[model samples]
Target: MLTSTFGAPLAQKSARAKEITKCIAVFMAKDMRPFSVVENEGFRLLINTLEPKYHIPSRQYFSQTEIPALYKQTKEKVIQTLRQANSIAITTDGWTSRATESFITITAHVITDEWEMLSFVLQTRPLYEAHTGVHIAEILRSAVAEWELERAACGIGVVTDNARNMDVAVREAGLAPHVKCFAHTLNLASQAGLSVPRVHRLLGRVRRVVAFFHRSTTAAAVLTSNQKAMELPQHKLIFDVVTRWNSSLDMLERYLKHQSAVAATLLSPYVRRNAREIDTLDHADINDAEDIVKLLKPMKMATTVLSDEKTPTVSLIVPLKHMIESSMAPNEEDSATVSAMKRAILDNLSNRYTDVYDWLLECTALDPRFRTLPHLEEDLRQDVFRRLREKAVQLSNKTNVTMEEADEGDGGEGTSGPTPAAEQPVNLTGTAEEAEVEQPPPNKKTALEDLLGGTFTEPAVAESQVYCIESEMAKYKNGKPISLKSCPLEWWKENAKIMYPLLSPLAKAYLSIPATSVPSERVFSTAGDIVNVQRSQLLADNVDMLIFLKKNM
Candidate 1:
C-alpha cells in the first residue's frame, strides 16, 4: 500500500539499485570498512534520507554477491592488461591474520610499452596447508598458472623477503633469477649496528624517557606547555618499534627536536614526583642518540627511495649500496663508539645479495645513469660488459625467429592478429590538455661519425646483430648519462626505438624486476585492514576478494 501511494520503489535488480549496491561494495573495499556498516543505524538513516525509493541490501548481499562480482570483473581486466606487457616480474610474501588465518599475496610488476610502471596485486590466497617450502612452491606455481603467465615475458623474476623459507620456496619452485628484498637486507644491517652494546643501552634509556610521556598525562601536558613556552613545534614523542630500526631513528630524531621541552618536563615538579619509577636519559645518552641519528639518516633515506613502486628500482641496488658503504666508512673524527657502530653496519652490509651479484651488476651496467659503474673497479666493469655482450647474443637468437615468422606472415604478407596500436610517447609537459610536443630528439651522429663508429640502427640479420649490439654498447657508454634525478625508463621510452632497438627490450626485461618485495608486503598491509576484528568471521575466500579488489580496483 505504501509503495502504491509513493509510486513503486526501485527493485533490487534495477539499474539504480544495483549501482548503489556496487558502490557500497567499493566503499567497503576502498576504505577497509566492515560490511556490517550497512547494518549500522546511522548509515541506514543516511541512505534512507538520500534515496526514499531505493532499498539497501543486507551485508550478506555485498559479501556474497557484489564483492565477488566486482572481483571477477576486475581480475579479467587485470589479466587483459597483463597481456599487453612486454615483460613482467613477480613479488610475493606471506601474512597471518588476527584470526590466525594464513594468507600469501602475489603481485606482478610490469612496464607498459609506453614506459609507465604498473603493479598488480594478483592474489591474496588463504593458505590451508603447512608453510613448508614445497607447499609454498606449489602455491606459487598455481598462481602463475592461474594468471596464464607461466611462459609470458622473459621468464618470471621472483622477489621475496630475505627469509629462509622464501629462499627455499623460490629454488624449489624453479623460479630462477630471484632477488632478496633489498629493504629487508638494509634493515638487518641497520639492526646489527643498533645492537652494539653502547648504542643499545643508550636507546633503551631514551625509550623509557619517551615512554614516560606516554604513560603519565601530567608529564605529557607539561611537555606540551614547555614546547609552546620554548617556541618549538607541537610534536609528540615517538615510541620505537623493535622490528623497524628506522622507527628507532625516528624516535631519537623527534626527541632531539624537543630535547629542551623533554628536559623541562622531566624537571617539572609534578613530573619529578611521578618520575621516581621512570629512567631518564643522561647527557651521554643524548650525545649518543644524536650520533646514532646522524649514522642512520642515510639508511632511512635509502629505504624510503627503494621502497617506492612508481619507479624502476632493480638498477638502483648497486648505486645505493655504494652510497651506503661510503657513509658507513669510519672517519678520523669519529668517536670510538661511533667507529664501532660503523664497523658493525659495514660488516653486516658487506657480502649481502652476493648470490645475485652478477645479475645486479648487469642491471647496473644497463642503466644509463650508472653505466660507468663508478663503484666498481675497471676490471669488474669490463666483466659486466662481457656478460652484457653474451646476453645480447642470447636475446638476438630469440629475436631472429620472431622476425622470420613476421616476414613469412599469417597466410601471405601480413602477420596474424591485429597490429597493436602505437602508444604516444610520454608527455614531457605532464598533461594531455597541453599542445602536443615532439620528444626532444637525441644528438645525431655526423655522416663521418656514422661511417667510423657504425650507425645506431637495428641489424638486418642475426649474424650482424652481435656487432650491432657492440656498437650500441659503445655509443651508450660514451654518451653522457642523464641527470641522477631523471627517470631511466622515460629516457628509454623516448629513445629506445630509434637509438637502441636491440637493447631496449633487454632494458624492459631487467628494469621491470623490482629490487624489493614491497608490492607483496603492501598487499598484506591492506589484508590486515580487511581482516580486522569486525570482519574476523569473514571466510578466507571473501578476504581474498576484498583485498584483491582493494588493491586492484
Candidate 2:
C-alpha cells in the first residue's frame, strides 16, 4: 500500500532492502562513522522519537555479519577490475602513529583497455615484520601476486620518494629503475629555495607573529577586536606545519591578507606583553613575503596537477618541469633574496629532474601538446623519437591488426570490442611530429617481447596492402596535434586504436604511471584518520578491510 501511494518501497524486510542496508554499513566505514551508532541506546531513542516503526539491524549483526560479507564481495570486484588491465604501476610508503605503531600502504595505477584511468588502495596493513629491505620486498611481491601480475606481459613500475630506504627496497624487489615522486621532488626543491638566508629570515619573522596569535588567547582576542574596529573580515592567522613547507606558503599568504589588522593588533596593549621585537614585521619584511608568494604560487599549482589520482599525470611530468623552470626566473630589479632563491631552485631542478625527463621522454612525446619536445636539445630530441618509434614498431609486431583490417571498420582491429563515444573530442590541431627520424635497427625489441619470447611470425616490411607499425607512426606524426586543453587519455580513446592500432597499447602503457607516490601518501593519511586514539584497539585485519573497501569502492 505504501509503495503504491508513495512510489517508493517502505518495507525493510525485502531482499534488496537488506542489501542496501548492508551497503550503508560500508558507506559508514568509508566516512569513519562509529559502527555502534546503528544500535546504540541514544541512536535508538532518537530514531524512536521520530519514527518508532522503522527498523535497522543491531550493531552486532551489521558489524559481525553484514560487513564481512560486504568486504568479501568488494574484494572480488576489485580483483576482477585489476585483472582487466594489461599493466600496473605501484606506489608504497610507511607511516607511523603517535603510539609508534608502524603501517605500510600500497597503491596501484592502471589504464584500462578502453583508456579509462584507475587507481586503488591495494593494502594498508600493520607492519609486524622488521623494516628490512627483504621484508619490504616480500610485502610488495605479495600484493602484486594477489592481482596475478608477476610477469613481463604485465609490466610494473614502482614509484616512491628518493628516500634511501625506499631506494634499497625497490632494488631488492627487482622492479624497473625507481620513478621518484615528482611532487615530492618539487617540495624538496622548494624547500631548498626557501632555505636561502634572506628568504629564511623573512619567513622566520612571519612564523613568530603567527605563533603568538595562535597560542595566546589574549593575543587572538586583541586581533579579533582590532579587525572589528577596522570593520575588517574576521580571520585567524595560519601557522606553517613543521613537516611540510607548503604550509609555510599558506602562512605567509594569510599573514599578508590581514596585514593591516596584524599591524593594528601590535598597537593593542593586550598583545604587546607577548610580542617580541621579531614580531614587529615591517613593510620591507612584508614586501619580501609578497615576493615569495609570487615565486611559490606556480609551484603550488603544479604540485596539485601532478597529485591528481583521476587523471593521467605521468604525461604531464616533463612539460610541467619545463613550465616551472621557465616561470621562476628572477628579474634584474628583484630583491637579492628572491634572486638567490631562484638560483637554488634552478640548481635543484637541474640536479634532480634531469633523471625525470629521461624516464618520461616517451610519455611527453606521446602527449599531443609536447609531441615535438620543445625543451630538449636537438640531438637528444631526435634520439627520443627514434627509441619511441622502435618501441611502437616492436609492439606492432606482437599484434594481429593490420591497416586493411582497421580500414574495413569492424571496430575490433586492436581490441576485443568497439569503444563507446568519448565525452570530449580529441584535439587535432596540428602534427605532433617535428620531422621523421630513421627507423630503429631491426635488432631492437621491447623488454616484454624479449622476456615473453619473440613474436609468432616476422612479416616482411610493407607487403600485400597490410599496415606496418612504422608506417602507422609516420602517418600519425604528420597528423595535427591536439590542444593542450584536451585530456590526453580521451585523445587516446578517440585515436589510439582508431588511428594507430598497433601503437595504442604502448601509448597507454607510458601514461599509466602516477607522477608521485602522493597517492600512496594520501592513502596513509586516510589510514591515520581511521586509526585514531579512540579506535586504537582496532585489529590490523579489520583496519585493512575497512581501508580497502573504502578506497576500492
Candidate 3:
C-alpha cells in the first residue's frame, strides 16, 4: 500500500477503484428512505426550490395511472364517511369555467336533528351539455347511486336556491317535504318588488345619474365639488342591493336640502341636456317642488327607520285596524291637517296594504291539511281572516257602505210605507240564537237555513211574526235596519279552493321559505376561494379532495 495524499492506495489500482465505488454506493443506499413516510411540508419546500432551478421533467413526479387510482380510493372513502349520517340534504349548482366546460358541484349536508355541513363533493363528470332540469337530475342521481346511496334512507332533505332546474331536480329526486330555502325566497321577493314599475323608474333615474358621474372625470370632479359644498358624506356610485335603495333616497333627501346646488348643477353648461331634463320632469301627483319634497320626506324617514339596528315594527294590519276604528267613531274636533293625514294614510293603506294581506292569505291557504294539524290550521286561518276582515271593514266603513242584513217583512199595517228600525242598545253578551233573532238578515237567506247548510248566518228578525204590538210602542222609531256582514267569513268560504292549496305544507313551505339566491351566492363564494388562479391547474379530483378536506377536516 502507498500513501496517496490523505489516504492510502493499494498496489492493484483497478481493485482499489472498485472498492471505493462499493463504499460510495453503500452510503447512498443508507441515505434513501420510503417516499410514503416523508412529511409534505419539507417535500413541498424541496419541490418549490427545484421547480425554478431545474425542471424535474414535467408529468413524471405525478404518475398518470395514479390519478385514477387515487380518485377511486377517495370516492370510496367519502361514501363510507357519509354513510353514517341519518339524514343528508344536498345543495347543488352548476358553473362554467374559463375554458367553457360546465361543472356541477354537489354539497351534501348531514343533519342529525341538528343541521351541519358535512361533506362537499364535486362530481367527476364534466357537464358539457346544456344545464337543464333533466340533466341536473340525471347527474345528481348518478352521483348518489355511485356512492351506493340509491336505496339509503339517509337522504331526508335538500336545500337549494330558486333555480328552476335545481328545484326540478330536487323534486324529481323525491325530496319535496324538505325545507325550501327561506333565504332564497326573500331574495326573490326583494328582487320582484324592486322590479316594479315605480321602483324601476326611480332606480333607472338614479342609475343614469350615477353612471354619468362615474363615467366622466369632469362629472366626478363636479359631483365631488358639489358634495364638498353641500357637506355630504363621501360615497361611491357602486350599487349594492339594499344600499342603492337607501342611497337613492339619500340623494333625494340631499337634493331637497340643498335645492339651489342641485339646480345650479342641472343648469351648468358642462352638464348634459338629458341630465338637466330631470329637473323639469313633472310627477303627476307631486306637481310642485314643495310637493316633491313632501313626498320624499316620508320615504326618507322610512328608509332611515329601516336602516336602524332595530327592525321597523310596522305591520300590514295595525294601521288598517286603527283607521277602521277611527272611521267607525271619528273624533268630534278633527282638524283639516288631521283629516288630510288620515286620508293619505288610508289611501296608502288601501293601495299597498291589500297585496301584503293577499300574500298572507295565500300563505294561510298553503295547507288544506293545516286545518287537521291541531291548532295550527285554526290559528293561521283565524289570523289571516282577522287581518283581511279588518281591512275590508275599514274600506267599507270609510266609504260608508253599510253591509247588513235586510228586513224580511213589513208590520201587518195596511200601509205599504218603508218602516225604519230605531237604533237599539246592542246586547254584548247576548246568546248566538238571541242575537240571530234580533238582528236583521244580512242577505236573502235565513240564518238557520244557511247555518244548517254549512254557512255562518248573520242575526235576523223572524219573517212570519207580526210586530204590530211592538211597532205601536213609542220606543220603536222608524229607520232602515242595516244588516251586519263579516266580509272575511264570506271571502274565506268563497275562496276555499284558492286558500286551501296555499295552506298546504308544500305551499306554506314554498311561501315561507324566502325566494332568495343566498345558497347559490354562498356556493359561488366558496368556489371562488377554492378554485383560485394559483390552483387553476389542479385536477378535478384533487380540487374536490381539497374542498372536502377543508370543509370537513
Residue 144 lDDT, candidate 2, scale 0-100: 70
lDDT, ranked from best to worst: 1, 2, 3
- Please provide the root mean square deviation of candidate 3 (C-alpha atoms, Å): 24.0
Candidate 3 local lDDT, 189-211, one digit each (tens): 33443444544565566555555
- Once fitted onto the true fold, the runs of candidate 1 whose alpha carbons sit more than 4 angstroms away are 399-460
- TM-score of every candidate: 0.88, 0.81, 0.43
- For lDDT, candidate 1 versus 2, the one ahead is 1
lDDT of 2 by residue, 1-553 (tens): 6446445643787776576577668766778755666767876677555544446777767767777787888888877787677567888888876557788889888889778888888887678888777788888877876755443232467888878777778778766536888888898889998999988888888888888888889878888888898887888999887667688899998889888889888877777866756366777888888988988898899888887776678778778888888876768887887888889998888666454456587777877667777788878877776666666544443222322333444653432332121111111111224222233234446777576544443433434113466676666655577787788788889887767776677777677878899888886677776777756766777677778877877
**Model 2 off-target regions past 4 Å?**
1-21, 45-65, 151-154, 225-232, 276-278, 327-331, 353-356, 398-458, 461-467
Error of 3 at 236 (Å): 0.5
What do the candidate models score in CA lDDT, each in turn? 0.80, 0.72, 0.39
| TM value for model 1 | 0.88
- Model 1, 72-104: lDDT tens digits are 999999988887775668999998999998888
By summed lDDT, which 10 consecutive residues of candidate 1 come out lowest? 420-429
- lDDT comparing candidate 3 with the true structure: 0.39
